[model samples]
Target chain A: MTETRGEPDVEAWAESGGRERAAWIGWVTFAARLGLAGVLFWAGWTKFTEPVVLQRQAVDAYQILPEALVGPVGVGLPVLEMVLALLLVVGFATRLTAVISGVLMALFIAGIASAWARGLAIDCGCFGGGGPVAEGETKYLQEIVRDVGFLALAVWITVFAPGRLAVDRKLGL
Target chain B: MGKASRERSARERIAEQRKLEARRDKQVKTLAVAGGALALIAVAVGVVVMADAGKDEPAYTGPLAPTSRQDDGSVVMAKEGVTAPVLEVYEDFQCPACKGLEESSGNTIKQLAAEGKVKVVYRPFRLFGQDPLKGNSERAANAALCAPGDNWIKFHDRLFAEQPKEGKVGFENADLISWAADYGVSGAAFESCVNNGEKGAQVQAMTDHAFNTAGVQSTPTIVLNGKNVTDQAWSGDDLAKAVQEAS
Candidate 1:
């Protein structure tokens, strides 16, 4: 099959530098995929048990979105997070999921930044239960930094496709 | 290049095209299945959420009195003697700042109310439901409204006095019942009302009023004659002075 089929380009590439590079990329991809999956899983799972109420409060506290948008965002965000987590964990449509994950992280970073700039004294509500932070307990800087770190992981996964053990690769994405 | 090699390359190109098409087919199939699964999960979650949104709250049949309810169903803590110039004090039961505001100026406000100087209406405003405190503010507010007649004020004051510390459970049903008893607001009817959460709707309605209608962002927002006095620290004689000025 190897002789009959058209894979000389792959063979030649493998012979040159592709084998070592692919192996390196695979390990990095695996680690990045698992890392982001763990984050989304933890974040989404925390809110799932409690359901929509606190999530709504968190959304309201941002004070950025319109009233009409609040209910849908509050109800839908955690579900999306969990769905994205599942996709990331199983490495299905890895590039698409990773891009989404990156977008979410970027949004979180922006939200926290805006809240901090506005002197809102909010809890970032990244995992859940976000509203006005308890008095004198504002941690906006730390929240922003952590979200930035998550954003970096997401960006890496987006670019590299996380091909190792990924359903995307199996489907030749 | 030789003819044999050229032919082999052409054949390889055809095979590559076939492989690419097969890969695309697989990808399309995977995306379709994944999208369907995601939609199914989303629909399931939406249904569950919608079902929970339907409150099992029993009707507020506990007690009835001559209390004035605002447009949004928030009860106005209306006294008989005072008629004009409503002194609206927006407060949350669990908010520490509100507790402070009440502690500092509660007496002055009560004295003014007794004197019929200003009709003080304690509007229930909630915050901190999403935190570890959960829905305690809303629950306490509900319990306050559920208190029979003039007993709501007493219940309101006592709640602030025994207001739990920040980042803690503010009040449970049993605690509310016991406190109501302490404030001479006890009975089987009242207990049933609190337990059954009959006034939960009223509580939610009032909270929405404070947030949406009144544009109340935080607790302890003091308004006299519809003028906001939230910026001023009316800690001492200033509170009485402000009330007097409003009149």
Candidate 2:
């Protein structure tokens, strides 16, 4: 599969297909990262705007964890989410960013699941306040299921594709 | 040596290598920039959307100080110790927000009740009356009423804690029995009361009183010191201030 003159080896290149495959994967990575970043950014923004609601959620979570850690975790989660969203969107250390997003989604799923299991009728507060959990309605299971799907997509991008057309690669980092 | 031919070959090779390197670099840079830009846009959009969504939510402007009936069929208001304030709460057991109010403010109200500063009255309304088999408001009210002595508060809290959200499906007879066991109440007594529709009339009367007499329109319509506190922003601090003023 040798090419004439300086042209790349078409047949060998076709067999390896590293560049072409990367390009295709890049598009997938781009779309997934964008979608997930949007979701995280929105969630973090909600927490930031309504600190009280976030505090309530944190306190509810506190019931499941050590009291000492609740305040710090509550305050840190939104900020951390913002940073992760930025990282994912900007293509800064893409694989690392995707992993962080995946982990956060997993944690969110766990939190909702635990709250449901404990029979706590509180809002998930993934997006800030609406109303408390109404009798006979458990939104947690659905929420967890959604997060699982997002996590799967994130993991796929993290492992197989470089964040398509990101600044990190542009900066040669 | 064929100096001319060798020179041309060397130049060509160098030029080809440089072009290949440049192409690779350009592709990499383009990919990186595009990815980064997309992420940033997503984050920005997310932030705006989330903020808007938060704003669209309705603020909780319902009752501040909630009151409930004790097992002895006596009205227990938190203002007894807090002041001469009268607190009335119209609640539905199946309502999730009512449950939140119960969990969050139950202790504070209990303290006020013990102090005998506030007069609290609880009116139970059946919001989920549409569901006959699953709605637990009537049963919960009956169970609390049938509880022995001062076990009403304990039972009330337990009901809120165990109550499921709408659509999640609540406990059946067996589950309720287990929950009663946790509260040290005899399952048989609780079950009998629930099954026999005990306190059903009382619950109905109270709900009717709230709507017709008290002009209550919501599950948690609180009256502070005889003045209706419904539709007012009732935070913990606000409640304390109202108590101080009434005192």
Candidate 3:
């Protein structure tokens, strides 16, 4: 009787193009969530394990914050990134986390752009170990492009957050 | 439509609206709690860090011994003609571990020098080979050179107090000049000396001598009576013992 309408195992379900498209979209979003989580975890863990002295230096390389703010921002950013990654892993408040992650990526892109504009040849410190690079070694374009790719993934998760195996779906979020 | 059927449909729509409201409320509450938790954790960590970093040294107000600038861009502080153990402290302004050494042993060394118990030689050198870190070390060393012998010690302490993070542009000429004023070491001559980098070559020579000739390859390398007592002189208490044992 259920097959008369549209059983998942039957041909009737294949007739709906919208369902197929949505299934594909769900899979892509799920992949983005994990990919974003992996990148964020790595970024956070690298800085967390490094000495605070180095992290402070890396933050100073940005040259955006005041000297007074440098210590706190340097110390806090890594932990916050890890927390966001955990939240993504559990798929709780995923859309919100993606939006926050996207904003962070945008800020990073802006900082790199500002540094490039100011003629400073410092490393972006995305994964830690920031400072002056050797001559002809500043990869401003590459850093920006990579961050933009992350931003795109973030956007995808923000739009399609209720993907497969997400806690959001289990909770009816 | 019949009244009974219309009434039933209206009731169903109301129930659906309530269910949607409940879901929205739950999502908002969940997000709010999560965001709040994240913020609390971050702020707590920041506070802990700030508290730890804010322990600055009180200014040394005791009698300072006579200081003489050596030809090799080093400042020696000791009683005139007093033959005592030489505590040659090799430091770089940009190095954090050097800052640690200053925090631990700086006061003890000053006290020993004041008491004529030891001949303390403050040798600031460029440990970093690259810019902008190398640049910071050189500038701070040059600024120390510009300060007259006794003032150089104060400049040394001041540089450590506000030691910038590595990989940053620090020890700007203006800041260098201003720091000297804190110890009455300011004048047009001093300002011009800092701005023109008058002791730039001397700093380079000192760095070369420190690295290439002295064979010292790290910051906070304290050579006591020609013996490296750095490990023994880790703290003020340890430094005093080391100095006494060496004597």
Candidate 4:
């Protein structure tokens, strides 16, 4: 394709240190994607190791979803998390995976916010094994902050489209 | 020579463009397939787990069981002539606080039941500890359900008596069987019942009932006439007063 008059010139930009800047963004994106993947994998693995019933009960404690949906949501969530983590790690379908990750995080944030608002003393169940928290042990603020941080990473990956060492690069994504 | 070479170069550029387009199409196709497969696998896992949800073990048909089982899977103990209001006690054996409740007021409550002053209904609420499936709370609840009500109560007391610290594997399967024998619930049939964990499903159901139906969250939840009197823990006099007030 021919560059328009006002369009940035790749050759000229490279001569003006744009190469180092692009590499810098690529490396940062790579690190953020890897970090998010690691977090999701660890969280999913913890929940996976526990019984599916435990997960169900944890969701039941939330009392947010209808009883029928609880079973499917509880069981599917950790598996989905692990799958998304795997794709992110391998850099396959990075943008799509990031969108899913963002959606999940947003749902979680809403769940936590409601629980906090309602004065329900329950664990967020982010990693695994959550239920009613004992009196004076709720950590809603910290959990929300952490999830928001992860959501930020998800948004960044989705928008910036990290390329270095990614399957997306090879696939012309 | 120059004209022929230029013409060949132009043809090569067109071929290269076709290759790039083909590669892009193939990559999109692969990604779509991979994404779809991953989603299908996730849905399959969820369905399989949900299918496994209601898999109850064979119902308990052993001896010394409850005379009347509640609809929510809890066992009821009603003295022959007791006409007093029912005192529903929700407890988990692995809970130290539950043990504290039992140690301080277990005898008082049993005496009340013995005297027919109050019909104490013991419900196994297995909310204590981390592991939902293999936790001591579930194991002890399962063992208790296998035994008859009278023997179960005896075993229940002994369980609290030998309650291990939280976050520890105190109720080994073999040890549970042996303890049942000590509580006068012995023999091969009883041992097999405990070992096989036939009432595993019932225990799980009871746990769910405690949470979903009864709305009881923690252990040692004393309900007098369906009103939670957990504030009256560790004090027999206070619990008795509350029960009296309720009646």
- True-structure lDDT of candidate 1: 0.71
lDDT of 3 by residue, B144-210 (tens): 8888886567778899887775456888999988878988988899999999989988988988888
Q: Give interface RMSD (Å), model 3.
A: 4.5
DockQ of candidate 3 against the true complex? 0.20
lDDT per residue (tens digit) for residues A31-84 in model 3: 888899999989988987765556777787777899798877777788778878
By TM-score, the better pick of 3 and 4 is 3
Superposed Cα deviation of residue B24, candidate 1 (Å): 4.6
Q: How do the candidates rank by TM-score, highest first? A: 3, 1, 4, 2
Best model number under lDDT = 3
Per-residue accuracy of model 1 over A87-172 as CA lDDT, tens digit each: 88778867678888899999988988987777676787778767666656899888888988988988777666645887766755
Off by over 4 Å in 3: A1-27, A50-53, A132-135, B1-122, B127-151, B159-202, B210-247
CA displacement after TM-score superposition, residue A139 of candidate 3 (Å) = 2.9
Error of 2 at A52 (Å): 7.8
DockQ, candidate 1, comes to: 0.05
Cα TM-score of candidate 3? 0.66
TM for every model, in the order presented, reads 0.52, 0.51, 0.66, 0.51
Write one digit per residue (lDDT tens) for candidate 4, span A24-129: 7677778889989999999888877655545665676677889698767777777778878888887887777888899999999999999888767678889996
After superposing candidate 4, which stretches have Cα over 4 Å from the reference? A1-17, B1-27, B30-44, B47-51, B54-56, B61-247
lDDT of 1 at A100: 80
